[model samples]
Target: MIEKEGFAALVLRLRAEGVTDLDLLTAFEQTPRTQFVPPQFASDAYSSRTIPIDCGSFMEGADLAAKILSKLQVRPGHRVLEIGTGSGFTAAVIGRIAERVLSLERYRTLVTAAQIRMDALGLRNIIIRQMDGSSGLHGEGTFDRILVTAAFSAMPRFYADQLVSGGSMVAPLILEDERCMMVRLTKTGSRFEREDLFPVPYLPLASHIAQHL
Candidate 1:
């Protein structure tokens, strides 16, 4: 658990950095990064840097997480589909704002670890599953919001296909030239509208759930 004064300072810094979404900030306060990060990186959990996790995965910083989740425009009754449950931190944050969240991760270890943390945090609205997230979760049905954590060489049509009409999605779309940018997509009557957000650096979406990166 983060100390009260220390957590207050972190929240103040987030505000100064222009993380203006009140609900996201509240989620940040509710789920301390320390509780979701590896023990070695606990001290630097609040830093604006990505930290490494097991199986060669990395976890996003609080500000970036806040930005993407805020972009999703989640509502209290919205069901979310998260493509990566790297640290379970993002899913946890979304769980606080959305009605329910189905988070899919490639690595079994990560899935197990995330589930443990979610249980510890008492976040009952989020479900962590070990599955190849690139394919999306058809068995679980569609969702009102979808978030893709990894960058892809092309827009992943599969995920877009899984979104309910009028639903929103935010992901980092990597181009054939290897450049990457965040994109906000909305499903609309058999078609999906795309909006390119700002540029960001993220690893390519894995083709399959590998034992190691």
Candidate 2:
């Protein structure tokens, strides 16, 4: 468990990492990262590194999640979709801000763990689905916001099509060099504009191009 001073330091570090949104920061502060990690790894939960969970999945650190949420411009009453629900911490945070959150995890174990965590936290607005996150949730169109936690070589056209006119998405993108950048995309008319937010390392999306090849 992070002490008050330690949690404050963590928040300060996140702010330095460019998470300046007050509401997002508060959500991060309120959610206990330790509760999302496996019992053995709980001690390292507050660290700014991905903590391994069941089935080789990991819980993204607060900094990465904060950046993604901030860039997505999440707001109350918005419908959000999160690809790769590892620990449900991010989904819980999104649930606090958005009207509804649909989070998918490819690994059944991870999905179960996330669901348990959400239930324990009393997060009622999040729906956890065990499915292929890369292909995305079929039939759930036109989301107010979308956040992909895993790194993808190419943006899914289906995700873009699902975005509401002014909706936004934030994901770790794998570039030509195999490097990853936290990229934010926002829909405008028939196209979406991309912005390079920062660098990040995330578990590769289960449906990555490498898998297809």
The candidate scoring highest on TM-score is 1
Query: Per-residue lDDT of 147-196 in model 1, one digit per residue for the tens?
Result: 99988787677676688889988999987677898999898887778998
Task: List residue ranges in candidate 1 displaced over 4 A.
Answer: 1-18, 211-213
List candidate 2 segments past 4 Å from native.
1-3, 208-213
Against the true structure, candidate 2 reaches a TM-score of: 0.90
**For residue 48, what is the lDDT in candidate 2?**
67
lDDT of each: 0.83, 0.79
Q: Locate the minimum summed-lDDT window of 10 residues in model 1.
A: 1-10
Clashes of each: 0, 0
Candidate 1 local distance difference test against the native: 0.83
Question: Candidate 2 — worst ten consecutive residues by lDDT sum?
Answer: 204-213
Model 2 RMSD vs true structure: 3.3
Model 2, 84-127: lDDT tens per residue? 88778889888888899999877777777788888888988999
Give the per-residue Cα lDDT of candidate 2 at 152: 84
- Count clashing pairs, candidate 2: 0
